[model samples]
Each structure stands twice: as C-alpha cells, then as structure tokens.
Target: MIESGFAKNLTGQNLSSHLGPVSGKGDVRVGFFWTKVQLRTKNPALNGKIVNRLCIAKQPIGDRYTVSHAYISQQDAARLYPQEFGIFTQYETAPANGTPLSDIPGVSRSEIGLLELHAITCVEDLLSLHPDQVSQIGMAASRVYKVAKGWQDKKDENEEILTAADVQAKAEEAIKAMEERLARLEANNTRLQAENDVLRHSASGHPAQSAAVTTAVQAAAAPGDDAPYEFPDDDGFMAGGDVVTGNDDLSDMPDPMKD
Candidate 1:
C-alpha cells in the first residue's frame, strides 16, 4: 500500500534552513537537490540565490497558500532528522482565479493543468508574470515564454471587441431605462384620460350638443305649430289694421269694399 505520509504542517512550508544549512558543506552531489532526504524545500534560492527566484516554481494558490516541495539532502540525511531520506510534498493543491488555458490560442488541457499545478491559471495571471518566474514551472522556459507572449498578442488584437462589448452593455442599459420611463408616461396618460372621462360625466354642462337636443325635445313635446314662430317681417305692424287685434274698435276690421 502507498503511504500518503503523515502531515506535520499540512501546509506546504519549507524547512531546509530550520534544519540547518544543506548547500555548502559536503561530498554531496554538486547539482543535486537535498529534497530526496525528505526535508521540505523552499524556493531553492531562499538562502541567497535571490536572482534564481524564477527557477523556483511557485504556484499562486489563491492570494494565500502554496503547495511547496520539500527535498531531502545528504546533509539532512546525515543529521538524522528523519529515520531515513525521503521527499515530503503537498499532494493536493488549492485553486485560484486564473484564465482557462483553453481560451488561449494554442494551450492544451495538459499544459493548462501543468500551469495550474503551480497556480498560474488565468491569462491575466500568466501574462503578468515575469518570463524568468514562468520558467520555473518546467518544460522549456522558452516555450512557456512564447506561449505567454502569443496569448498577450491575442488579447491585444481582440481589445476592440472587448471595448465594443462594454459599449453595447451600456447602451442596452440606457435603452432599458428609457423604455421604463416611456411605459410610466403611457400609464399616466391612460389614468389621466380615465379621470377626464369621469369628470366630463359628472360636470353640470357637459355635452353641449346633447343639452341642445334635450331642449329641442321639450319644445316639441309642448303644444306648438309645426312652423316656427316668425317675428313681423315688416315694421308696419302698427299701420296694418290686422296686425294689432287687441283693443281695436269695430272700425279695426279690414273691409274689402274700402280697397
């Protein structure tokens, strides 16, 4: 059975310095890592190789946490920290926000997974990184640099499209706001029209034509000649004997003999 190994810190902290210097003193293999002895390793250059920081593959695990590797050395083995020599490493790595490799022009899932193993997942993260730092993740440093450069170029080319998308989103929001305002105006207009109709019905002198018709009906119901009453066509009513029939004496009657 494979032993998952006992977890001390469980966190991927390197302890080579704490155990004592592993690099300077020995018959130890010249280019060998002390990792085989099971002492946790740091970014290899932690002691003094600050310039070699790029060679140290640090996976950005969120804003926090890193699954660091710990290698054992002959010095560590000789010191007898562990019963024997063995490498202790974090098996499971945590996740962070990085661009998908698939979105990149030529990156495959495997290469994407490789980058993730070190915590560089997104295009932004990948591009933001220094070429030297990217080199630590493995394969060939040149190829990684090439891929990152290519993706950066792709991003540059598509910048216009991104800008257009932002513009479109803002325009759509503005149109939606305008439509809502128009709808409110329409609703208010309809309500006002209804109120106007109610006021017309409740008014004392509404429908002038209808009131005229009603007056005509009442006049028709009253006893009256079909012909409309006419005023004196001439102003000679006073001179005509038939015009004023009121207090005329017997002499008021018209006589055909006189004509």
Candidate 2:
C-alpha cells in the first residue's frame, strides 16, 4: 500500500480519487495504466505472490490519501523496470507527434468516434486519408486541414521544447546499441585478422603447410561462402575489411576444425 501525505515527483498534486470499475472478485485485480496508479486499499487478493516494493505510489482516496502504502498493478510495476527509477512514467513524452483526434484543437469527442470509424484516427491519418473521404463523413476539408495543421504545429513546438537531457537520453540509447554492435564486430574482426595473420605466418616457412591451412580454411567456409562471418551471438553481419556484415545465414565448420 502507498503511504499517505504530501505528493512529490512527476505527479505533484493528490491523485484524483475516481471510483474505478471494480473487476471480478477484485481478487485478480488488473488494469493497464500508462503511469501506474496506486490503490489505497490492500485487499488480500492483491497482496502475497505478486508484490514489488517499487510499484507503491501515493494516491488520494475518498477524504484522505495514502502514499507509499498503496500498490500498483503488477504489469505496470514490470513496465517500470529496466529504466532508471525516480523518473516516473508520466515524465516520458509521446514517441510520436500525433495524438488522439479529440486532442486536436477543434475536434470534439463525438466527432472523434465518427472519424475513427472512417479510419481517420489522428492528424497523421489525415495525410493518408484524402480530404474527399473525410468530407464523406460530413466533415469539412478546411476543418480537417485546420486540425491536421494544428497537430503539426503542436508537434513542432513540443519537439523544440525537448530538453538537453531528452536529447542525451535518446543519444545514449543509440550509442549503447551501436557500442554493443561494434564490440561484436570488433571481436569478429580480431578473429578474422588472427586467421589472416596465421595464414601469412604459415606461408613464411611451411609452404606446404600454408597451402593445406588455406584449403582447410576455404573448406571451413563451405561452398560459395565468401568471407564467412555469422558470429555466434545472433548479431547481424558487419561487412568490410576482416569484419563482414549482412546476411544471417550460418554455415557449418569443416571436419578439420571439428576436432
């Protein structure tokens, strides 16, 4: 259960205490929360097996509120993991510019559903679905254009407001992914480089041995398998130099290497 008191973090004010739909025995409680909402109650069904200390959040209920004592959904708790904590899910912005049609400046809720039925879900959808099709739903082309333009402007404005931290975080993800890939490639490259070095070393003295090694190496590569890569880690191939990229096709090692 979430503890009671003054609020802090991403959610500054007391959480609105709306009586949510009670599902089942409230025993197997479940709901999908974008940012997990904590329940002030600690029903037995919600406790025991599916508990995580981090899922707890302060939320107002009835006259009073609880903080740290309330528990959130298990799925929500799991969702919050893998990323650094303290920064709650609420802080994250939408991945894309477009929002629900009702969120557009002049679009109303009732009209949103009607447009949704026509597959005109968001402003981005407007770009795909022609204005003529929207007009079929009795919506003016100018009005649709206005909402779409507003969403575009809003997206641009919000994009400009992105903090340096946001940019850095995105960069970090890209860099992390790149570093992991580069490390695998570097290792594969080193192995290939070592093999090439061995072939060169063998050629320096033992001409016959070098010839045998070359044949064995070529045989290990298999028929038509040029510059064999396919590292064991399931990483995609990295071509060029000793490190070859592209193609996930794995080939068998020759009988000589089987020993």
Among these predictions, the greatest TM-score belongs to 1
User: Relative to the true structure, how large is the alpha-carbon lDDT of every model?
Assistant: 0.55, 0.55
Each candidate structure's TM-score, on Cα atoms with residue i matched to residue i, is: 0.31, 0.25
Per-residue lDDT of 256 in model 2: 46
Listing every candidate in turn, what is its Cα RMSD in Å to the true structure after a full C-alpha superposition? 27.7, 29.0
Please give, for residues 181-217, the per-residue lDDT of candidate 2 as tens digits: 8999999999999999998886787888778889888
Q: List runs of model 1 lying over 4 Å from the truth.
A: 1-113, 130-148, 157-165, 199-259
Question: How good is model 1 by TM-score?
Answer: 0.31
lDDT of 2 at 87: 42
